[model samples]
Target: MVSPMITEKVISNAPYAASAVTVIAGFTVKDWGVIIGVVLTFITVIVNWVYKHRQDQRESALFNQKINHHQKHKNN
Candidate 1:
């Protein structure tokens, strides 16, 4: 007996990069889940890096302000 094939609809502009995929090569649903997970993890890492960079810039500005204030007081 032949097994029934599954069909999924995909948008042309989907992030997966493919309009449609046919799974005749024994690629299972589990494999697709892993691929998606990896992509999401990469995106999360980039977002975290940007957030930390902004935080560091803000801290540096505050530190510079403190140093300038102390220098002005010492000169007076």
Candidate 2:
């Protein structure tokens, strides 16, 4: 029974409505700050882990190449 225009409006306003509800439900500014900080920390940790993994792979490859070169020269 809902019209397309009404559905669009509700979807657009959904975030605002949810935010208002959370405030009314006693979610204070400090709670939001802590939530944001925790999310940022988690994202940072994931990024660092990925970077370290890639670096380790590069070092392993380089070491293998050096070992191969040394072995080839030694066999000559």
Best by TM-score: 2
The lDDT values for all models are 0.77, 0.96
Candidate 2, 1-76: lDDT as tens digits? 9999999999999999999998767968888799899999999999999999999999999999999999999999
* Cand. 2 Cα-lDDT: 0.96
* Cα RMSD for predicted model 2: 4.4
Q: Hey, what RMSD does candidate 1 come out at?
A: 10.0
- Candidate 1 error regions (>4 Å): 1-20, 23-26
RMSD of each: 10.0, 4.4
Model 2, C-alpha of 14: deviation from truth (Å): 11
* Each candidate structure's count of clashing pairs: 0, 0
Q: Quote the positional error of residue 39 for candidate 1 in Å.
A: 0.7
